[model samples]
Target: MKALILKRYGSLQNVMFEDISKPVIAPDEILVEIHAAGLNPIDYMIPKGIFKPILKFNMPATLGSDLAGVVVEVGSKVTRFKAGDKVFASIFDLGKGSLAEYAAVPEFAAALKPDNLSFAEAASVPMVGLTSWQALVVRAQTRAGHKVFIPAGSGGIGTFAIQLAQRLGATVGTTTSTSNMEWVRTLGADEVVDYKKQNFEDVMQGYDTVLGTVRGDALEKALRILKPKSKIVSLIGPPDGAFASRRGMNLLMRIVFSLLSRRIIRLAKQQDTHYSFLFVQPNGEHLAIIGSMLESGQIRPVIDRIFSFENAKLGLEYLETGRAKGKVVIELKDTTI
Candidate 1:
């Protein structure tokens, strides 16, 4: 099996293409022959050690989460899929990632890929799709007539979130560069603020929820646009105590996160709005629903570019530029047995 393995956490130079043993599966898992892998900020962040404290990984680990491929083998307890099934998933197990020829995924995290999508397109959906679903549906409880604001409307998560929010009956608002304003509008954002020309905080107001993919001052500006009792879900964050407790971090780490998020949490409280961090998790059921939506044309993937597996490093570099209009993917040759 060939994989993009990280020998140590540091620069991109730490990553190497190497032959590794095929992944072994547990009773509740499936072995997927990956055909394509999606690249996200976390792909680079992991190797840079940015998430070391929360998502510690062993040396020589693979570095990807979203994948689309065929199931080569299913564990004893697996019931939803079998050999030859086309599936996709965002695997959360940091050790067994999708940037390899084969990956072992929990059965509950793998869903049948939509009939209408190619492997590359399906691979681009899992992480960003689930992030939008989790932030808007699970966390914010967005419903019809609600106003939802999403920053970076042309990026991976924003592209998906805008469409999903509109599908859920929310009036979607988003920020993008002037060049991408008309493009993002096709995704159904009711209000498109050209961030390069106008500030989103000044133009948008009275939102029921704000999905924050950009943090720091961008997140603060988002906070100011919300009405009282609104919710802001941040994906980039100084995570809150609840997140630390959910991940079952040590007391010291928990305290660290508590102190890290204290100021924002207090600010949110003072404004009578709620702020919480979201870490998207994998769920086969949710992916299944999203797949159905794709099948029905309720949501469409926006792919910025596709790189060959050999150029996976370049794909990550492109994503880091913060210029991709949508998702970037790495396509692998299919060699399923």
Candidate 2:
């Protein structure tokens, strides 16, 4: 099967398109014939060695996380799906990814794709969808009447997060460029701050939760807007000891993360708010819930563009520009075996 393999950690030049043996499934896994793969920042960052310390992958690793496809085979212990099942999953285990003709996914991390979506649209959901679900519903415990602020409302995660927060009954506020303000409003953000024309911190305040996806002073600004005892969930930077412990990092790594997040953590405390980093994990059950939401039209996918499988490198380059309004996908021509 043809797959995108990284020979070494570096730039796009390290990504090689070549034939590789199809992965065999474990007892609790399923082999999926990938029809489409969603591109995320982590896909490029991994090959750039940005996450090397935390996520160690062998050379010649595949570089995708979200995928929608058909199940060609199921492991002996698999129960939720079988051959010919249409499914989507976020392969959270690094290195073992879906940017290929086929991928082996843990059964518990795969879910039936929504009937309303195409393979490309479904592929775009898993990573960003689950990130929003876990951060808002699971971590922040968002509820009706709560004020939720999400920065970068036009980006992959932000697009999904805004809708999900609104669905959960929170009043959503988000940041986007002036050109995207009206567009993101369609996603149900109650307040849209044009980052070019206005600062989010000045316009939105007293939030119950803030979902921070950007690096730099965005997290600092997010902290200032929260009401006392509010929570700020950051997807980028300054991962704290709690996150390190959750990932079961070594003592050395834990110490490193603790020291790294000390200042931000202290600042959050001083403002009478809590700050924690979120690393989205794979969970089939959560995907199932998201699938239902999609099926019922409670949430919709926003796709920026779809690239052919052969031009995946160009797709990654497009994603790196940080100009995309939503998820970028790579569509495969042959999914049937």
Q: What's the lDDT for candidate 2?
A: 0.91
Off by over 4 Å in 2: 334-337
lDDT of each: 0.91, 0.91
TM-score (C-alpha) between model 1 and the true structure = 0.98
Q: What is the TM-score of each candidate against the true structure?
A: 0.98, 0.98
**How well is each residue in 42-117 modelled by candidate 1, as lDDT tens digits?**
9988888898888878887888999999999999999989999999999965457889999999998989999889
User: lDDT per residue, candidate 2, 34-57, as tens digits?
Assistant: 999999998888888888887878
lDDT of 1: 0.91
